[model samples]
Target chain A: MTIEQIRKTFDSFLEEHLAFGQPEGLYEPLHYLMKQGGKRLRPLLLLLATGLYDDRFERGLHAALAVELFHNFTLAHDDIMDEAATRRGKPTIYKKYGLPSGILTGDLALIYAYEQLVMGLPASLAIRLMAIFNGFAVDVCRGQQLDMEFEMREHIRMEEYLQMIAWKTAVLPAGALQIGALIGGASEEEAAILHRFGLQLGLAFQLQDDWLDTFGDEQKTGKRKGGDILQQKKTALVVYVLEHGSPEQARHLLEALKSDELQDAEKIAAVQGFLEVSGAKAAIDELQRKYTREALAQLASLNLPEARLQPLKMLAEELMGRKG
Target chain B: MTIEQIRKTFDSFLEEHLAFGQPEGLYEPLHYLMKQGGKRLRPLLLLLATGLYDDRFERGLHAALAVELFHNFTLAHDDIMDEAATRRGKPTIYKKYGLPSGILTGDLALIYAYEQLVMGLPASLAIRLMAIFNGFAVDVCRGQQLDMEFEMREHIRMEEYLQMIAWKTAVLPAGALQIGALIGGASEEEAAILHRFGLQLGLAFQLQDDWLDTFGDEQKTGKRKGGDILQQKKTALVVYVLEHGSPEQARHLLEALKSDELQDAEKIAAVQGFLEVSGAKAAIDELQRKYTREALAQLASLNLPEARLQPLKMLAEELMGRKG
Candidate 1:
């Protein structure tokens, strides 16, 4: 089935299952965020992976919802930690409700995610899924912690930054697809291969995100260009500039990034110019392509029929090609 | 085994199993809270319930730790929500570490709790335990939401108050015991009975806490007398006064409670005097006795061997007689 059909199936499942219309403060934010949908990439990937081994999409629906819910839970809490005012073009949960409500609702979302994870699967499969789900959950939290810590630290190596993003952004998709593979009757070896595939895919995905934030058109990305630059986020581009640039260049770049004297637009333009001069933008793109190639290679090693693998290949390509 | 022995075993298990010494900021708060070590009541109840059916205490150790970890996770997050500065006579996680760290550490604790819950258990039992654990986890969050909501409202009915505390405080104990029973190989019927028993015990436990906060000697309770009253918390004593007193008396009590004009000492004395005059103190004590009796009766009805039931009865009695 098409990704759209898979997303529709997952969407209806969430609407039917997620608790609603009670305890307005707690459930309202939940409904608000869940309804304001995004790419639905994780769930769609999960379903497609599951489809490769099993035709019974219904079997993977709850697990798919579980991934989606867990992803949103992290987003809600991360918005609070980042002090982000908006998400997906709307007020964040912290802004829409309040801090305490945001925390509680994020917590509720996580608990419900676990509930969905174990809903109707056989005991053996449910236990396995939970183990994978929980391992990634902890990794995601740790990743967020490291990201927060990075903001306060003075220096971060390229290796450290990659590890951070791998934990923060990559593992969820990796776990989702691997979980899908397992639930779809893949062997342990097969699941491990898909997990590797997802890890590379996730790396490429995040790099593309970093690329889009600075270079993509606002109309297509649905976000202002260079928002990350303005926020002084330590994206791959920044890391690249820090690593390869001379001491003077690095010092100047840091000054330009941190100077409150500069207007938002000025800071972004200055940082972008520095990145261009240092060839950091091209470096980041090259790294993204390398990971995307590695991900496709992992897919090739799986020995699945080419037709069955088309959807995943298309997803990886679309992620690479996305303006957003 | 005695509760002390069981606690010692659980502590050792935690030491061997819990991740430590890495990501100091995230792990430290978790260690701090877990090490501070309150009553450890939930895990003890779980062990005792498990003991009723089997002496394989080692089998339930991980699950017992899961309960303790989960309890601490709630305390850490709840401290942030209440903006509390201290817990168990030391600085809270939020006070010592900061808000974001506290939130992240609590999240890690919760994730690790799930890990502990599923460790070493067979697939079938793990799934059953997880279902029970997750259900109460959601209920506890709902209960907290209601409790927070209560602070903003003018009036809360007696029934609503009971339900709130039951969800907020009682269900965890109820679930812990039921889970222990299941792990100990109890039939569904037996687990249900223990659950009912635990519900009554939890209700009595919370009411006793309400009584102790207002009336018990501060020296013995390790807290100032009337701390709850000072915070204007709507406890059973206040609920009783509202239900039993005349409208004029109730109005006077509410005024005295709400008035920032009164000194803390004067406010406590006024509310205490009102409770005494309205016989609300006696009424609360009576309710506590009723629940305790019902709890003990449920235990009796379990019809276990006399020796097997003694520990639970002693626990109930110890809880009732505790000065703190």
Candidate 2:
């Protein structure tokens, strides 16, 4: 099936799976947030990875849903941790429901996600999947803790930022791909390679997202222009400018970051100007492109049939180039 | 193993397991709370359940560890949700390490707990344990949410209060017993019966705990005298009194609950007086005794040899009568 057909089917399963819980007051915030919906990327990756190995990818649907549900669980809780006001162009779960309800709901979603996985697979596969999922869950939490720590530090290196994104956003998808491949009867080494490919691609995807938040069109990105600048996020572009820019440019950028009273327009102009003049945006683009190349290289090393690999390569390009 | 021996083993495991991650800023709070120590009641239940079938309970130490880690995970997150100042005579994780760190660290502990469980059991047992653990996890969250809900409502029935405690504090032990039984090769029916026994006993345990919270010596409980009264908790005793008290007593109780000037001493006295005049304390004791008797009946029905059951029975009585 095509990516659209796969996405539609996966989205249907996610909705069906998420709706199976009892809707007491405790679950209100969780249900609200899980239904708010994001890109459904991890589930799609699982589905696609399995399909790449076998035409009968439907056999892996339960695994796909498990990854998706787990991903949403992390998002729900992460929103609480980040004190995020919005997600997916909507008010966040914590914003809509109080912190306590949001936390409990996130927890329920996580437990149920494991239930979904174990319900379908053999005990052996289910156990392995759970172990892998558990590892990913810990990595996500660690990445988040580091992200919180980064907030307290004065300067965050680009490498540190990359490592954090790799942990936070990349590993879950990487795990999903590897597990899906394993379920589809891929060799262990091949699965490991695919996991690396997915991790690199996921990291590149986040870097592109950071770049788009600063440089892409407001209408396309679906938020205010320069929103990240206004928030003074230490994205790759910001780190590049901080380290590489002229003294005056650094002063201007730091002034924007330091000043609580800086107008949104001024902060945006200062950071954006520094990024453009310092070639940070170009460097970011190059970094993203490099990872995309690495991801494709890793995928090619899997030595799968061309038809099976084509869809994934296309997905990588789509993810890297997309506005949102 | 004896309780002291089990405690020593668990203490060593806690140290080794918690030391796996970086023990810096974000992780320090989690380590502090987890290592602060409790009675290790849940793990003990797991081990005891296993011992009912075989002395090979040593093989299930990781599974038992899963119980304690999950318990600690709940406490860490719950401390944040309750905005609690202290736990176990020490400052709470959130209070010590800020809310975000506490949330992430607690999350990691939970993931690691499941990881440990899967490591100990085969896939089938692991999956079943996960499903049971997840179910217990949901009930725990639901109970907490209901509890938060209870704080706002003035009149909660004793029956509802009983159900809430069963969900909140009791299910984990029930699950621990059931999981242990299953791992020890008990029949599903037998495991389930033991689970029910544990649940009922835990319910009785919580009610009796409320009794001790008000009446037990400060040195024994290791908390402030009448701490629950200071918070105006609607414990089983309070709910019983509030429901059955005469209009005059109810009026005085309501006045005490509403008064900002109500000192800890006054609230305790008011609660004590209401319990006495309304015969609520006796009523709660009777209810606790009835549940305890019922739980013992269930345990008897398990058909274990009296030699094997003796310790558990004695422990139950000790739990029922303990001042702390």
Chain A TM-score values, per prediction: 0.96, 0.93
Name the lDDT of candidate 1. 0.87
Mind giving the per-residue lDDT tens digits that candidate 1 earns over B6-80? Answer: 878877887787777445667777888888878788988898888889989677888999999999889988998
- Using Cα atoms, each model's DockQ against the true complex is 0.73, 0.64
lDDT tens digits, residues B18-129, model 2?
6456326656766776787888888888877888887887766788888888899899888878888888668888787777777777777777778877776777778888
* Location of the lowest summed lDDT over 10 successive residues in candidate 2 chain A: A14-23
Model 1 docking category: medium
TM-score of each: 0.98, 0.94
In model 1, which regions exceed 4 Å deviation?
none
Tens digit of per-residue lDDT, candidate 2, span A1-324: 888898888877766766544327876676686678777788778878888788888777888877877887788788888888888778887788778877777777777777777777788878877777877877887788778777776677777888889888999999999888878878878889989998999888888888888888877767677877777677888777667776677677767766778677877877787688789888998998899899999988887888888877787778887664
